[model samples]
Target: MSKKVYLVGAGPGDIELLTLKGMKLLNRADVVLYDALVNPEIFQFCKDDVIKVNVGKRKDHHLKKQEEINELIVEYAQKHETVVRLKGGTPFVFGRGYEEVRFIVKAGFEPVVVSGVSSTTSVLESFMIPSIDREFSDAYRTITGHDMKSFSEIVTQYHSRENLVIMMGIHNLKQIVFTLLEKGYPSTLPIAILSKGTCKDAQQVVSTLGEIEQKDSLFFEQMKQLTPAIIFVGQTLNATQELIAK
Candidate 1:
C-alpha cells in the first residue's frame, strides 16, 4: 500500500504550543522529517525505529532546495512509510507547506494537515501588541520582509501601511527598517520584534522605526543572538486598550 503523508505545523519553538492532533500523529509517525526551527523536544515523541531526517536551514547555511524536499517526501511515501513533515510555524505561512501538499497530491498520495498555534499570530500576543485593534488600527496584515524586497518597488509600496506583521524578518531587519522609512512610515511608529517566540528563552526588542539604527548596539544586539522571530508594526502597540489586561 502507498503510505499517506502528513504535513504538520509544529508551531514555533515550544512543544507545548503544538495542538493535540498534531502531537498524536507525530507520536505515530513512521518517519520524522523536520526543520531547524522546530522544537527539539519533538524528537522525544518518535519511536526508536523511526527515521529522522534534518531539512533544517540556518542563517547563511545552505538549504535543501524546495524541489529536493518535495521529492524526498514523495519518495518516502512511495516506499510504504508514513511520512510526517514537521514544520515550524504553519506549513504554508512562509514555511512552503503548501508546495509540499501540492507535490504529495500530484504524486497520487493524499496529504493531511494538522494545524498548530501560528507564531505569526502568537508573537504579537506574547509582546502585548494587538494584530488588529478596532479602536487604534484600521486593519492588521502579514507580509514577508524578505519576499517584499524581491520586488523592490512593491515592498516600498507596502511600507506606507501602518498595521502589519512580518514573519522571519529579523535577519533582514536593517533593510526592512530603511525601506519603510523611505516610504513614509512614521519615524516614531512603534515596532516590536520577538525572537524565539513561545520558547523559554524568548527575547523582544520594541522601539520606534527610526531608533532601530540609532540604538542598534543595545537591544537589537541581544536580539541577534537569538533565533526564530517575528516583527510587528503599527499604532496598535500604543493602543489604550490593554491586550494583556484582558
Candidate 2:
C-alpha cells in the first residue's frame, strides 16, 4: 500500500502490444492518467473500481498542459497507493515520459518505469521495412520531423548506409522532403510514410523524394489526414520494394 507512481508505455495502439509489466502495474494502480494515443481498451486491465483520467495532448489541442499533468501525477501518488501514467509508444520516445519522471523525482517520489514496444521499430517493421539490414544499412537515426529548423540542422549529411525514421512528421511531409532535397539528399531517395502503424487500419505510401515533390498541394493536403504516421527514408526501402515485387 506504499504510495508510488508508475510510468508505463502502452505501445502503439494495440492492446495486445502491451508488455506484461505494464499490464501488472495498470491492474495495481488506484488512479490512471492516460494519453490521447493510448488505446482506451487498456482500461480493461484495471479493476472496475479504478479511477481513470484522460490527459491526452494533440497538436493545436491540449486537454491538459505538461505542468498540469506532472502535478496530477504527484497529487495522485500522494493520495493513492498506486498511480499510473500511461503513454503511447515508448515513454521516452517522444512521449514526454521523461519529463514526468523528472518532476516526480523532484517531488520526492521515485517513479517506476515499465518499457513498452516503441512505435518507431514496431510500426515500421509491421510493414516489412527493416531499419537495419545487414547488406544495406549499418546505422539508423530516429528523429523528429515536427521541427523543420532543428531537423535540417541535425541531418546535415545523408549517407547511403544510414536510415532515417522520422516521427510526428506526416503534417510536415512536403517541407521535410524539400529540406532534404536542398540538403543534397538524392531526388530518388526512397521515402515511405506509414500511417496508424500497428493498427488494423494501418496504411502506407512509398515513393521517392522527387515523386512527392512533384505532386500538387492538394495531394499534400490529403496526406495531412494521416497524423500519427512515421516517415522513413533510406536505401533499405528499395529492398522492401524488391521483395514485394518478387
Candidate 3:
C-alpha cells in the first residue's frame, strides 16, 4: 500500500466549524501537522496514538520555515500510511496549503484536499458584519495588509458599495486607514477590528477612519495587543448597526 498526504482545513477558531471530512481524516491520520491558529479542541478528533506536530507561524516567530514544512510533509508521508496537514481556514486562502501540495506531489505522492470553512467570511459573520449586504454593498474584497507598497499600488481607488476584508493587517491598521483616507475614502467611513474571532475570548472594536486618526498613539499600541485580527471596512456595517438599533 502506498502512503498519501492530505491537506485539511481546520476552519477558524471554532472546533465545531471543522468539516466532517477533515475530522474523519484527522481521526485516521498516522501523523498530523497543524498550525498555531487552529483550535486546540480539534485535536480531540485525532486518534490516541496519532503523532501530532505543530507547524504554526506568527508575525516574527515561525516554528518552521515554509521550506521546512514542505519537507516535513514529504518526510512524514514516506514513513506513515496517512499524513494530514491541518491548516487554519481554507487551505487555498493565504494558508500556503497549495505550496505543500506541490512539494508532496513532486516527492511522488498524491495529495488529498479537504475543504473547510474560511475565516474570511466566518470571522465577519461572527461579528454580525455582512460582507455583502445587497442593500449596502454589491461586492467585497479580501486582501492582505502585510505589504504596504503592493497594497497601495493594488487598491487604487475606493468604491462605495465594496466592502474590504483585510487579513494579517492588524499591525498596519493606522497606515491602512490613512491610505484609504488619502485615496478619498470618507473620514466617517465605518471600520471594525475583530480580534480572536470565534474564540471564547473574542473581542470587537467598532470605530471610524476619522475616530481612529484622532486617537493617540497609545490607542494603536493597545490595538497591537489584539494580534491575528481582521479589519472590516464598508457601509454594510452601518446597515448591520441600523438593524440592531431597530
Tens-digit lDDT string for candidate 2 (192-232): 98989888899999999999999999989888888788999
lDDT of each: 0.77, 0.91, 0.91
Which one wins by TM-score: 1 or 2?
2
Per-residue lDDT over 92-125 for candidate 1, one digit per residue giving the tens place of the 0 to 100 score? 7877888999999999998888887888888677
State the lDDT of candidate 3 residue by residue for 17-88, as single tens digits.
Answer: 999999899889899998989888898998999999999999999999999999998998888888999999
Q: Taking the candidates one at a time, how many backbone clashes does each contain?
A: 1, 0, 0
TM-score of each: 0.87, 0.97, 0.97
Off by over 4 Å in 3: none
Give model 1's TM-score versus the native structure.
Answer: 0.87
Candidate 2 — worst ten consecutive residues by lDDT sum?
1-10
- Which candidate's TM-score is highest? 3
How far is 75's C-alpha from truth in model 2 (Å)? 1.2
